[model samples]
Target: MAANFSNSLVRWIDHRLPVFSYLRHAAYDYPTPKNLNYWWNFGSLAGISLAIMIVSGIALAMNYTPHVNHAFDSVERIMRDVNYGWLIRYIHMNGASFFFIVVYIHIFRGVYFGSYKSPRELLWILGVIILLLMMATAFMGYVLPWGQMSFWGATVITNLFSAVPLIGESLVTWLWGGFSIDNPTLNRFFVLHYLFPFIIVSIVLLHIVALHRFGSNNPLGIDIKYPNDTIPFHPYYTIKDAYGLGVFLILFAGVVFFAPNFFGEPDNYIPSNPLSTPLHIVPEWYFLPFYAILRSIPDKLGGVISMFGSIVVLLLLPWLDRSPVRSGHFRGVFKIFFGILLIDIVALGYLGGKPSRGMYVIFSRLATAYYFAYFLVILPVLSKFDSSRLLPKSISTPMPEVNGIE
Candidate 1:
């Protein structure tokens, strides 16, 4: 029979390579916490977005000329002449924003559920590394367009390295591949932009391996003591993820078709002009909060340190928050502070998008202070003294209503 032959063929190959068995264990037979909610969907969504980015980027690169003189013209040609090039470019262009959106949600979910604690510290660290790499890759890709904003954005950002004490200017020169941003700079960025995604894919595999070691953290933030606390990842979560993907694609298609330039700066449509500088230069929306933090401090070196410190604090969160309990559901005070932290970040982002003048600078400094204080001071103090409700026994255990968190 056809089915029997297929099974025999699979067995014959799987015995030699074990690739099918590995996939079955990783995707189908893996145990995941049953209490995971819609928030968990973002992890899979992020992976899907990365795939979209990689495939579309490769196609775009086929038509893209990475030299500064030809880059902008080539992009225009792709839009005007190449068959379906506009669609591919739009998908890739808008996909970056959507990718950040998904990853941001996934990160906040991890923070809320205390997924970074204990055995998962390395997992959290790896996630942060991925974020850093994404930032680098996105920055490089932004320059490849060779537009007005892209040119000035690169100039200003690369100049930030000059804030370093001794080797600053030399480092900047090395980065630029000459005295300034030119053809060489663009060529190098093109190569790195093409390369970082595959590196990300490798880290993602390690992330998955680390994830399966500890299983998944649930909304309850409790360990799976009973076997019934978990379910096979395949049929249940796979179907759930597919549904999420459906909804995400609808939104993505709407953006690509109706408002592909929704996230783009108008200045970027013009070719790069080294002599002319735009009135206001801003990085992409995702980088705004860090930009605000960077500009908030008075000294250049201090600002750079603070900007990087914002992420470093997150990397140290597992050791920083000494709380006995995990999820914010059991810690009312921590939950309130977490909400305030989110608002502070939003305020910082808004401030970052605006000119660094008037009340914007003042508010940004305040928000930046709170951003560090929440992680450094608030979390440590709360961990020691906050009266958290008792935790449930396991992921499947019925949580008692202390103040109605259930």
Candidate 2:
């Protein structure tokens, strides 16, 4: 049986793209850091999460209708008629939240450990692109329900691009494919939402490929520096990533089964009516900080531009953080800035849930200012003034490079 399977696989490989050699390099023979903890598992874990999303989303789509009138009802029908449809829907829904959670942790792990430093910059940039795609996909998913929040949220969000100068109104029309976000908008969002994940999958593959070229950064932000520090991707990282994946799955299953709708908005249960808006049109929790930024300014265009600027600023972090040091462990000023950024994100989240009013608006501006300050003022200043402890150079130093080819 083993011989037959191997023969078939070899034949198939001969007929298709060259994959075994790359797999051999990346998984079996490739060297990696033996010191790497479970945190490093997130890259693989993220790939798995994406796969789960695509599979579940495709299944859900089998029953989904694109029309506004029947879209919500069709979802309900899927819930009621399709066997285990509820389970499927909940898995996809909570899976999105879970996906974001892991990705955020992944991003932070990269940031905290200086995974975005030279050689890894492309991978990190790819990560930023992935994050943007995820936000767009999630927003489109929200709109699919055509729920009250979905309706108003679409209106409010789509209108933000109108903050542009001459092209503003035209851009809105282009986005809508018409006068407003009606049937055409829903149709495009549905198509693009379905399509974008495939693009993300490709990007993620590129991200890993880039990561393989550089090897991963360690928790200490030190070079592999020695022979014993690294190990092969298969035995070392495979085990670590599997363990993390098991733990993540437990959390995922918990959300799917117990608190399925807990992260979702209650108002989404109601269908969209343009004339009627939800009491509050808050986006998902993951989007809270940006939402806060969007409502911070009285000037529509300024508020819109600032909200986008926050994300654009994240992309420039590799260029911005000129600190000789990598880890927050050693950089005093960088540590403080990291703390401030965390607090600012929380404050922005709070503002997102509140009414766009006196205190909320003021605090939103404050938090928004702090948000930009972290990457712009804080990071740049720290990189300039923060003194870092020196250490051994290269992955093959005192800390021996592991399984990777030297």
Candidate 3:
């Protein structure tokens, strides 16, 4: 049969390089929780999205001119002149958004299921590092377009460093590579933008290694108790992941082909002008919540610190949440607070996109407070006082049908 033939070939290749054995062990025979659901698919989805970005990026780079003088025109040229360059460019542009979409879902699933606790803390930390790296890479990539928003965005974000007591101005100057965001800034961003994706790949590999070491956290949040509680990664989870990938790709393609500019700013189409500024400057949607937090504070230095602290708080999440139970499904109060936190974040994101004045500013401040309070106060307090429902004795226990699927 084909299976036997493939196994024989794998054995032969394994004798030479061991690549087949490693693949077989890692991808085929690896034990995965039998209870894993669609939420588990986002990790693989993120990986696929990264691959799409890297490939599309390389194609776009082949036609991209990094100089500020020609960068905008060069992008236009790619759209009009290069063979299928429009498709390549659109995929790269939207892939960045899709990548974040997948990663955010992955991270939320982790939090909802308490994937960060205990032995998986390091795994969660690695994912946070990957998120930071992806943000840096995406920011630099944005600046490479040499458009009004790209140039001004770089200037504004870099200027945040000037909030430092004595070194602020000097740090911004150093980052600009001159007096302002000119050719040097564009060139450096181009180089780093290309380089960072590979660095992300390296970190992703480390993330996988760490994940495999700890195994995956299932929705049940309980350790596997019997052989029936786990299944081989090959036929079971692989098929589930493949189905998820198909659905993701259909959505991704719809955006890339039909609404490529949905996530892009209209101001970014204009060439960079030192004298003119857009009426409203906003980053990509993924960064809006943090941006709202940054602008909520009146003090420049305090705003910058608080903005960064928003993300840094996630690094301590494993310890911040001291609950013995993992899944929010079993914890009624924590689940409600988690839903509120999600709404607060969406509000922050909306406020971030709006002008920082009047009621928006007030809401931003309130939402920012809740954002921090959720992690700092709510979670820790809930850990001590909130009662959780009894959990299934084992992951293998069959449950009543819910959501029409079970």
Candidate 1 lDDT over residue span 1-406, tens digit each: 1222258889787877787888788775688899899999999999999999999999999999998889999999999999999999999999999999999999999998899988899999999999999999999999999999999999989999999999999999999999999999999999999999999999998998899898888887878898898898988999999999999999999999999999999999999999999999999999999999999999999999999999999999999988877788788888899999999989998999999988999999999999999999999999997444477777777767754554
Candidate 3 residues 1-406, lDDT tens each? 1223257777676677777666777876678898888999999999999999999999999999999888999999999999999999999999999999999999999989999988898889989999999999999999988889998898889999999999889988898899888999899899999998999899999899988886899997877788888888988888899999999999999998999999999999989898999999899999999999999999999999999898898999999999888887777778889999989999999999999999999999999999999999999999896443366778878644422243
* lDDT, model 2, position 347: 90
**Better candidate number, 2 or 3, judged by lDDT:** 3
Give the range where candidate 3 is weakest over 10 consecutive residues by summed lDDT.
Answer: 397-406
The lDDT values for all models are: 0.91, 0.83, 0.89
Which sections of candidate 3 miss by over 4 Å? Answer: 1-13, 386-389, 398-406
Best by lDDT: 1
- Residues 1-406 of candidate 2 have per-residue lDDT tens digits of 1222256777577446556655667785567877677777787788899999999999999999999889999999988999999998999988898888889889888877778878678888999999999999999998998889887888989998888999999999999999988999999999999999999999988998898887888866776656666778887677778888899999889888989999999998888888887777899999998999988978999988898888888789899888767766566556667877878888998899899998888899999988888888878877887544444465455533322224
Candidate 3 C-alpha error for residue 59, in Å: 0.6
Off by over 4 Å in 1: 1-6, 386-389, 403-406
Q: What is the C-alpha RMSD of each candidate to the true structure, in Å?
A: 2.5, 4.6, 3.2
TM-score, cand. 3 vs. native: 0.95
